[model samples]
Target: MKIKLEESTFGLLLASLLLIFGGVFSSAVQYDYTAVIDCLADPLKPQYNGGIIINPEINDGVKGWTTHGGVKIEQRSSISGNKYMVAHNRKQPYASVSHKVLLEKDKLYTFSAWIQVAGKNTTVTALFKTGDGFEKVGAVEAQVGCWSMFKGGISVASSTPAELYFESNDTSVDIWVDSVSLQPFTNEEWRSHQEQSIQKVRKSNMRLQVVDQNGRPIPNANITIQQNRLRFPLGASINQNIVRNTAYQNWFTQRFTVTTFENEMKWYTTENTQGREDYSAADSMLAFTSQHRISVRGHNIFWDDPQYQPWWVKNLSPQSLGPATDKRLNSVVSRYRGRVIAWDVNNENLHFNFYESKLGGGITNKFFQRTRQLDRRAMLFMNDYNTIEDGRDSTSSPSKYIAKLRQLQASLGANSVIGIGLEGHFHTVNIAYVRSALDTLAATRMPIWITELDVQAGPSQAAYFEQILREVHAHPGIQGIVIWGPWSQNGQCYQMCLVDPSFRNLAPGNVLDKLIHEWGGATAQATTNDNGYIDVSLFHGDYEAKFVPQGGRVDEVSPQGKSLSFAVDHNSSGQVIKFVSHV
Candidate 1:
């Protein structure tokens, strides 16, 4: 059952249980996922550009990977000279070392790599960071090292379709990369990523700088910053020791021009304060996602719980939560009608006992009516966990969760219910349960997503990622999988991060790569002017405006790329056409 964020029952239980839970899973790699792609190229040779880790002196006696018209193609160690040397691919192309991976929506990923550029711009650098559907990183920098053996690594964050690279701000620089890898980082790990290394703590010349929103600098901001993570598990991270790095490296080929809600829209925090009806958080999420041209899910327009509704709701004298709730729903919805694309009309009704028991049998209908009345254009979904096979029996049960959902669909009339959210927040949850859940949910003819998934504790976690992803990807009805908390830093609940605090990738993060950006078949085109303005019609996927080129595609791009997922939206009347330009 969905619990409120402030619910002490679970919070106290979890807090009390945290010791046991933490101990039980301590050595289990907290992260069990694996790495998928491997950059086996070597640098120092004229042909290999910056995509390798070793420094091999090629003198017509050896061969290696090289670049042409910007695309790095794998060639047997043949011609080793400046002629066949490094030319940045205006297009970022990559040679495949592909392995199977599973990516869940909502889960965060932490990507780390050692990248260095000495002279010319490192365009189409290594596939520094990429994935099927992720778009942005706040900041990264080109670090310096004495040599290949001492190359420096930069830590960054990414979602699915992860990316990593040495984006050269200077056009006349050469960058070398080695030991590039990515893994998932959960909430707690996020806290730990910023911890001070024992060595750094002992440094004498280390002077810390404090800054503010405009970057004018602030002396006291450090105090507030430190307070944020203070209660976290790691001591220094709580000190707000994370660097306020400027000129952060932008690795992806695309930017999430649009914005999104917190953690793919959870039911708990959305309206926990009740009559207060504060949507600042959600509005901020949508607006950010939208400004970045990122599409966002409306999460759930209707979840069945008193906490979701204001206390004034349950106290409705005549039983109605008042036109305020309805008006609020309609107001918030209508504001984002076209921009916000999807909605979970109802969330986990089958998992809990709700107001429907007291209200008439109209729980589902009321939700649909309000949503349709406001955002008539949004896609509506009936989201639930346990949609896969039953965890208890491992059999695709038509009688339990799916059955109730189907009954709700029939009762609510199928037209209003557009999809299913098979949230795989498994505690003891298994792939069999997820698979079965999707099979039955798909029978309703609605597209599905593995909404809020968490591959709970132990060595089996990585395998859990692979199994669930393989099964989910194999299913035609599953459109997306939003894993709960990709990083440990933001996890309000537990420690399910794919990578731990040390900026390491878990095996699961590796497997999920295939699921994220590797959906394949992508092409991009855009134009820029002296004002650095550009206009273009990108496809229904992620894209970045880069001067660098990948393999087999267009050009006039930036050394750094940005992406936004573009999907079709058909209105009953006609298609909603949009024209956008980015700076």
Candidate 2:
């Protein structure tokens, strides 16, 4: 017989039936297993053999590879399974080995190999033929003795077929290349590889507190921990007045986290190469940075570029260059020893060797050693340009620059050069090339700073600026970036300045401003609750907290009742902070 039952009673009866035959009922539960099964399985990345080259090992002797200019099969030391190809410079400028491959549009390909230098420093560059010319994908400096593995990637923009090749240059060195491989990486794989190489440097959390002179908690403190990364000195640069200009200063103050006195601290500008010092401009620049509580980078202790050198330095006899260098370095470094955090010991040593040409190559070693001796506190940097912006073939490619640093490190005992300064002066940028260069230099394990980063004024300047800034921020190896200017001479316009002459933000400057504010560093108001304490977290930087005391009746003379302003910097961890409000 059918029994009439309420909805609740019927559900209970159904649950009871299911419980009595759990295994039978479970089969009818109905579940989607596709996503779960896929999650449990490993990801697949397909590799096509003989797609790019056959017998890449070259053990069978350059069978499928074509030689360009002076390349041959060599029995030299092998990187992997034995046998390799050697590109002999033999006093010539360049030699290369190449293989042709048909690539699809929009696919990403990476070409990698193990290479070693038989003689002097060897530079290996990855290239692809483009409509206009050969495009350089990556370059690396292989050491003379050991095998170094290097790889570079390319994003195919068009469906056109191109020959992918590895070329070695430098009259002084011969290169042995082995185990060449060309393969396509999935988006996930490429991103994962990039993420793995990126250094993990998390943003620091700053803990802050406010208290009165009697050590009592000061409730209702208005805290402004405005983190101007420009002020924090993240993408910092040398400037005389952006920190002080009314129309432009706000953009600079709110955006940049650091400052550098570009011309004020130069040897020629400071001493005029006559040994007479002018501390006024430099002092002002330092004071401005100090008042803002931003870090400062010393532009240069010595710059030996021939055309830019002081007239007196040029006239100095070969023997006098040494003494002049010593005097200049000692005088400048001693003045700003503890104040400046980093010093460009000798600017553009990679591009120019005026001092080296005259005082001998050993002079650069002496320059670093001497700088370290006097200014033992600061990070001494060997500043140069084109290391990242120019391709591997340029005089200042990452591979060549690293080799130069290695030479300096070998002679100066390692500690002499503590930082690598990359002058990121670019007109056009290839993100892949820049990333590859930085990755190669990161192998040095030294802190890398974008010393003179600026994009030229152009239609795409703003877009390029944002792209590069994001790239730099994403890279773990990049410690900080120092931009070139707020404006160039005569207001003609230059790359990297945030504001125009009218104090209006250029597109890039606006981008800079938006980034700084979006980081959301400071809390406008954090009132203390009934417990008479307010705990807040901030970005790792300096802060100013204004404490407004309550409870006392307001007087006509002091309506706010004696508000106290305290300048404090937040440490890594949020700690119980006691601020002495009254003296």
- The top-ranked prediction according to lDDT is 2
lDDT, candidate 2, 1-583, per-residue tens: 2322334455455434332232132212111101110111111111233236566666566777776556553544334335566766444444566677776664566555566676766566778775546777766666676666554556666767777666665756776666666665433333333322221232332345566556666566544334333223464554576545665555555566676776788877887748677877888778777887668888888786888787788998988878888888888888889999998877888788898888887888887888777877888888998877767446777667777787778876845457999888888866655665676677777899888878887898988787677666556568878887656535554456676667667788877766666434544556665444655534344454545435332121142323333333323444555545552
Question: Which digits, one per residue and each the tens of the lDDT, describe model 1 over residues 284-394?
Answer: 545444443445666666567555654545666534554544655665577668876677766666664355665556756676666776776777776665435333321
For each candidate, the alpha-carbon lDDT, in order, equals 0.39, 0.63
lDDT of 1: 0.39
**Superposition TM-score, candidate 1 onto the true structure:** 0.44
TM-score of each: 0.44, 0.72
In candidate 1, stretches whose alpha carbon ends up further than 4 angstroms from where it belongs are 1-260, 263-275, 305-324, 393-397, 400-417, 428-433, 488-495, 499-504, 514-518, 521-583
lDDT of model 2, residue 367? 78
For all the candidates, what are their Cα RMSDs to the real structure? 25.8, 12.9
